[model samples]
Target: MLFSLFSEFNRVDAEDILGINADAAILVDAETGRVLYEKNSDQVLGIASMTKMMTEYLLLEAIKEGSVTWDQEYSMSSYVYNVSQDYDLSNVPLKRNGTYTIQELYEAMTIYSANGATIAIAETIAGSELNFVKMMTEKANELGLKDFKFVNSTGLNNSDLINHIDDGQQLVGEDQEENVMSARTTANLAYHLLKDFPEVLETTSIPVKIFREGTDDEIEMENWNWMFPELAMKHGTPAYKGVDGLKTGTTPFAGACFTSTASRDGNRYITVVMNAKGGDPRAARFDETKKMLDYAFNNFSKEEIFPEHYQVKSNKTLSINKGKEDQVKVYTKEAVELVSKKNEKENYQPVLVLDKKLLNDEGELTAPVKKGDKVGYMTLESKDGESIEFLDGSSLKVDVIAAENVEKANWFVLSMRAIGGFFSDVWGSIASTVKGWF
Candidate 1:
């Protein structure tokens, strides 16, 4: 079979996400990190509460690593506690010395988009709000989010910062830049959050929750994301009805931004729409998102390869050092699925490459192969290729692993296999000679 490589490996670019009217937008396959569509996706803009996604992500990481716990009581600082109680900003009312569980603060920020609550937790995790914002920026760097510089835990604008910052104190960095993120960066953040901490959906997807029970401070909060099924059923276009979280953001600067995720059949997708300008910005954001989601769901489809097997489709095997069997079968960790535009699935072809490190000079798998150890990779290549410049190095690759543990073959077992193979070869040679003579 003849294979063509994308001469340049160009990725889906601004021109590909045509008809999406938002200032910046992106549509991506969650499983593959494949950019199905993009329009000015790397143009950085204020992300508003969408910054909360990073805040929440880091908080979850802190909890998971035992740096913080859901049950621990964290007291509020004046910077985080008093900012919005007297103002009209988006906040969860807090009282000085009124400590709350980290879970309560997380829910307040995540479900309600409460800025005060978010900053409170930020302080808990990083000892200072300034340090926490640094952590968010560091994470963006680690994730390769090229167009981001996080200034604050909440995506509040400069004018709004007055409510949070007192005197000349830093709202973000000492220089005072607002939180900025590109549509591509926002979508990437959503992908990592969903991939790593799926439990967030348990809170983000909920329509409403009570922050505190049987207390005067109890606040009934509602999720602002309209992509939830309850709201989607009423507000969404037909193709966008099963929308679930990621997050929503809006500010004078951000202008009605929303990051959305949806799952249908066996595929999950992330879509981001930023800065729907002018009249009814919120509606414009949602409208643009509906169009993007509609196009994505109705047009693309997933085709699974290796449907009958988890094992790599190869003759390759790991040589056992001391086991009954001479070799062990190697397999992929999971089936590989390719997402393509409708009717284009057949063009994606699998290319399996064995890891050079796993093989000896003789091209045999080395011994001490434990089950589940990574052994090789399976990559996808377009029958008609693209530019390598835009291709993600990891997008086309999936892991190949040992199918079962292979210990060193004992002397008796090795001798037996060797003798049996020797006789079998001799018999085949003798039979071939006899047939030729006849």
Candidate 2:
């Protein structure tokens, strides 16, 4: 559901993606879903707390639909309370039968990756976590997420947790149910969530926020997304500074998974690192992300594929038809840009294949053309390069439209053009005959 107005993918060489620390990983241009890099990206595995993203998304959807409000309060269920006590699962303790607003619990769930808070909110919206997880799977399918499945609102794999999925959900080949997703699926979901509800970042970016503040039960929570400025600073790497919002998940089954987004100099990137290797696997994910982002920010850039505003700057042009003023100027209807490694724009080329009937014997258009009328389209293609992988297909295509309206010429004018064209052809033929005689 990462809505891209333009379908462009910035693919990279396999060698360029070499040595990434994670078992599965991907780097994508967030806005365009242009996948810049990936390895085992489609392999599904336990996604751990990243499942809360679905829970977060459903909660936000409910809020938007007016089914729930941030101001609305719900009492802590005994099930949620019991799960909160499990230190094994990341949780903010929920007071049994105690009340908290949707806002407070949302902050707890998102900022702390709190298991209890997620399930409590899921139950509030879907009537039960089991049903909520079903909604999650449906949403995933709707988003074209192949092989991604959810069994609980929280990402915990322990069937014993029993707090989220009361229906005893289980996958066919797995012992117990655990929400599973490919890195590609997770990255796509993250892209859409960020696009639709950017406000989630306001909470996700908060390094430390107190839930139930001023109450005796107040608990201080910190974000696990090491990409965030506060946590990134702890890594002592200045390059990790721009990463503002994302979720991180770790479990025995999932290893370490981080779906991260970072923006710098107006260019933003999203990366998913899964099942990273290292003693400190969390750091491993961050390290791998740093590599991709570094390559992207340093090597690749966006370029406007141009010759616009009705002016044919390149060899491509619009043919004018039967009008007083012959053919009017034509150019790309929309502004578009190509992203690739620096200077690859040399191979980045455009092809102008216009509808021929629109053209005359001289390859000129029959005018009486209306402004903005699409006479044809120019498909831009970039030849395969040594390094950067430009988007496949017509990554950049624009409707070639008439720049100006051309009124029909009078009969006299039309006759004059015909006679002139005729004489011009005749003279060329005569000149050729004269040369042969010589």
Candidate 3:
């Protein structure tokens, strides 16, 4: 249920803006994995509570894998209750020994940015906060988040007890470093999760919503992200359209950070800002995101690199050596779309390469083939290394058949047959002449 806008407009320079000194930032195409714009993208820095994004990813992954379900119930422990009591950032008012459904906890965590709810969910998912942190680290590595690490579920500064002790000596102050992530890796993780589990957005995109149990008090949770309604109106720019559902963070050390996703005409993009300095981090995020969105929409477009039903030339038909079909026709699965600059159409070209072993030596089709068989693949590479799959629109199945039988004859047999045919032809010609005279 994600979308993007496909059009051309003048590009805007985002780096020239004021009050936008984030340590890292990145704008990437969600569908194509193309980096549209970036600044200090790989620099590791404190991302504050944007760590909740990974917490959300792990929760959704657990749900998808059947490890947990929405209606499943969990009880908060004293440890969670204590954190809730002390944290002023966000909370679901969870009391020790009180039961809440997994769905309720997720709503609270994502929509309300409830720190207490996040801890409860992490504990529920991994049986302990420490285990959940390990899971988060593992998942980050699994997703190729090279520049990120997780020591806590909420991304708050961990208590001194959580720090490693060296030779019975506790490291303190400047010697202690906290977990961090680069803007690019954070955006990459967000992009991968959102691209895969879009249902998470259904909860994240809600600015104001209510969750309750029958006869229980309705919990009113408001989205912390001001960009949804506040910035859209403030900017008065249509480029803000299709922007929705993400997290925002700010702290004295982490500064201000945001990971935002937007879609238009089927192209989705993710933008991340980290360690920004401003009185109001939300406003800064909104302004910076608007500029990025505007630049992306105005300068880039998604074009079909490979046309639908495109025929791959010089495609050697696959032959079945011993199957009923002797040959099979193979083609690409679908047409590919490329995100390219508006006026750079001349740079696009399609390249086809086939696996040498997949074809016969004579360049004829190979048999033992079936429909939907992948005999080969083509890469649609631009002048640069930017590439996409060629001819992958609708599934194109192999449509050719093999020879019914093999014509076999020895040299002697062929020569005898030829001689007999020649004698028969001469006899038939004489008889025809005799009949004409008569």
Candidate 4:
């Protein structure tokens, strides 16, 4: 799909000429959901252990739902143990009877890219790896992950393992299950997850570290992502500025793949490349990611599409229930940003649309409201009614609260109000009477 959502830029054909044999690629503005660059991004392709993005996402979701805790210890299962038995495997060496905290397992899975650690984590979080795979597929559908499947937590040789199933069902393990994902979709998933759960970056971005238990052997883990060092040298120390985490993946069938994300001065970007060909997939991904990042950071600047506290037209006050104050205040959560042409203010205009149903028919608000409550929404559209491209055409949410409360009116208060009204009326009458006599 052509992403006309953002203004297009001069195309770069270096990947083609340089023989960067990637089957699919995409670059996007993280905060605005703008597609900044793409090359065959929609073609479905095998993505290898970049599949772990889904695994990591599901694990975080499990934690959010209270199904798992970072400190909780879990036992290693037979399936995980068998997977670890491959001597050539880059295993985490988890013992069948030994236990590790969720945090330790997560580090192993993400940083060390330990297959056994991932399978154990899945089994621990969801009772079984099979059940966790089911959850992964279900959540994939929920998140609009159109071209993907999960038959195993470890992204192992499912193609060979499932060929024996006689049900004729397209078992995820058979050659029929080439766990596919498009560059755009993969980047979108990573971007959304990282944007929502930034803690993942905290683990993935570490350039190098040692994981150890006191008195136990230490395991050295290095960030497989190479863009950090490349950018550092190219830009001279802390290069690629805000560039940070993500993951790198490869397998013979999937070729090489990566999803890299970086943020600078509040602007974030995500780039994905799948099926690149080279000696080292991780290094290839790093080379491609650095090019994409340079293109973006050099060409674009984040422009605020809406100003903070910039009163949105049609915003209505909301009432409070049992609040210490009778009413509360609300506004947009954050100003939206758009990557526009160097100077395109004339092309920018944001419009507001409130969901009238959220307000009472009498035009009065009802509330037990908070500052960020979804009181209404506004859509920023182009003057021609075509939706704005950079804003992703998503409606911005507004809060519901009374800007301020009207002081209470009571019976005694009414009596005093009446007395004041009578005296004002008498004074006006005497003044007019005196003026007429004069």
Candidate 5:
């Protein structure tokens, strides 16, 4: 249902505002799915190794469902063996018919972006990379991702897999085509990944790990997401505070991209940068991402914009008919808290919308109303002319509920009210006729 809301938002470029030099980028409040800033974020482009995020998601899901196990061993397939030997790609060597546990391969795929380990996991889960790609597409749709396509599980260009792909496997686009996604959908994907599989952070946070350590297959794996404080400290990049596990992608066609998350105090932000500019694509993506993160952390603060039981200015009560009370008080069921721009608190306003199902012909609730009954919803809107858009393509809203119960009026009381209403109308009509005659 929320997927349909994606079409309503108009894409606006905010590149100049942040001096972001990239083909596409987006920044969002990870906790609330609120879009903080965006630039060309709707343009679909190659996502390279970032495709692994979906693979990681599905693998976690499969493991959770008992369809796959971390300790389960996968025998290296011919296709996997060939791809593993390709030194041109990022990989750890796998011997022919060699067996590796799901946990070992998962760490290699996640920490090192190992193409062979990724394909091995793909085949282990879906029997082939082709089937895994289908799963990725279906899962992307189920997650409400917009402007996305998955041709390979490893995010490598189809051309790279032309000779080594499994029999009967076909690519989705041209030979050069790689998995593609818009920055907005990518951010949405990350939001769901973090929300649904928070345990992923445990693996992604590892700055350095040895794949199959203490054996001949052992290889040191350094996280591609070098923006994390541990890696940044060692590599001499700006050490971003609270930076943690996420994914990065790069290719000749895709340039450089990173889907990164960071937290400060209690607030967290998800940022995606695609096709970053400058001679060093790797450094450029992180630099641009830092700019966006800096803009967010410096400008925004998590604030309780509206406290619990906050009543709307005008529509604070709902009229009740045939009840002991004339009306019932309605207020927010929960606090409306979100990451908001500091010093611009005046820009937001709460709007109330009542439920029509509970209203009678006279727009009043009939009889026995219970406290905490959901009567309406409260949504925040920009009082200023500026447009506010959420990453999920829907507005932020909270339930508005009744503050107390209202018992039905007694039969005698109802009869008396009806009689009194009938006489009042008769008297008013008679007086009007008398006045007209005079």
Candidate 6:
């Protein structure tokens, strides 16, 4: 039961800490993947253009692997040309048989949520949209996302693709569907995307850029992430501090969805808001996101609860056998820092676990034990029996290690100790028998 404290605590939901008006939403620590706040986060819902985040991830991987290049040109197919011309959908117009650089198409897809540009990037990576969808599904599995389904690289509903046709041909497959995922799954994908390809922010954070600037085919592309300072000011709203690169998705089926990241005072967060409710769905997603961000920034601050080399007060040293020394002191391998509430320090207690392999039947180590050897791990438990679990199902813990070395005793020393112990036992037994008889 040494580590049972980790699994026995009641998981307290902090959902009541803030109110978010959305169908599915989640806020997580970007670096540690800790769940800050969640509301219906595990419910699968249409993702709309948020699907493009996956496309962005794959394209970045291809570029890094030398399989694709930003300057590489893609010739528009009849299908892509037709979809690009639909002004109803978000897109920059692409001319028939006119090729555009991968950089231009990526900018269009990420900044404006252009369907045609995203589709072209998918084809370039996987040779066709259907094949790209398979890759999306495979990558989702690889990222450990539980609730997700990807039917296309672009999050456009299958109905939209089916309706948009070129030369009497269907644009999508026979099954009509859109990409769907839970908020947790979406957040997990974002976590892996940022962890693997951090440079993506260099491009995604661009507020505005012109496609083919100063040319006849030029189009002004403004980022759809209205949370950005420039975009927020343009709409006459106050900008949220440290808001930056991410993606937004909106469609009649999916409502309004946004996956956003923000940083302040050395800490960063990833938040997702899906199917936000408002007359202006675009504004609603941002409004809900602000509530979650405010909660995280106001309540949580990093603190070192336990310093390095800290030892358990109850058990300072462990017994060792067959060595020159009788015991060895063990302490934490490093300091333990937690992004916890200001007043929650009193609730935490340390739990230590010893490695069974190092011990014999008497629960003592058979040395020679070396300095800095890993004895086990030190975990924590809440005194109130209520704890907030991590998103990745891992305990907030640190390794426990031996503080010094203990060399094995020589054979002569061992024989002398054994003979002294035998005479001492005989005298003690005879004395005990005499006392019992009297």
What lDDT would each prediction earn against the true structure? 0.75, 0.75, 0.67, 0.66, 0.87, 0.83
Per-residue accuracy of model 4 over 1-438 as CA lDDT, tens digit each:
122322233333344422335777877887767776777766666777787888899888889889889999987666666665555555666665777888888888888777778877887877776678888888877776655556777655565334323322233444544466667678878876886688898888877667655525367766666556643464333345676778777767777788888887666888888876565554566677777777777777767767655455444344543334444554555565567544554465655555567556654445444445555544455554433432133443433223344444455756776798899999999999999998
Off by over 4 Å in 3: 1-20, 160-177, 210-220, 230-239, 309-331, 356-375, 384-438
- Is 2 or 3 the stronger prediction by TM-score? 2
Worst 10 residues of 3 by lDDT: 1-10
Candidate 2 Cα deviation (angstroms), residue 212: 1.2
Predicted structure 4, TM vs. truth: 0.68
Global fold similarity of model 5 (TM-score): 0.95
Cα error of candidate 6 at position 317, Å: 2.0
On a 0 to 100 scale, what is the lDDT of residue 256 in model 5?
95
Error of 3 at 84 (Å): 0.8
Predicted candidate 1 versus true structure: per-residue lDDT over 1-438, tens digit per residue: 001211111233625536776778888888777777788776677788999989989999998999999999987677776664745677778887798899998998888899888888888998877788889889888876665777778887655666556634466553335687677778889988998898888888787788797898987887787656556565542325567687889887678898988877877888899987545777667777777777778988776755523654455565654465668887678777767777876676667788887677766775667888887787777778842112132456678888887776667877988899899999999999999998
- Could you tell me which 10 consecutive residues in candidate 5 have the lowest summed lDDT? 1-10
lDDT of 3 by residue, 130-164 (tens): 78888988888777676566667776665522332
Ranking by lDDT: 5, 6, 1, 2, 3, 4
TM-score of each: 0.74, 0.80, 0.71, 0.68, 0.95, 0.90
Which of candidates 1 and 3 reaches a greater TM-score? 1
What is the model-wide C-alpha lDDT for candidate 1?
Answer: 0.75
- Distance (Å) between predicted and true CA of 222, model 6? 1.5
- Deviating ranges (above 4 Å) for candidate 1: 1-18, 167-169, 174-176, 229-240, 306-335, 352-376, 386-393, 399-438
Per-residue lDDT tens digits of candidate 2, residues 317-397? 554556787547777788656566677666756676677766778878775778888877776665664333211212445
RMSD after Cα superposition, model 6: 5.3
Worst 10 residues of 2 by lDDT: 1-10
Output the lDDT of residue 269, model 4: 85
Order of models, best TM-score first: 5, 6, 2, 1, 3, 4
Off by over 4 Å in 4: 1-21, 159-171, 213-217, 230-239, 306-336, 349-438
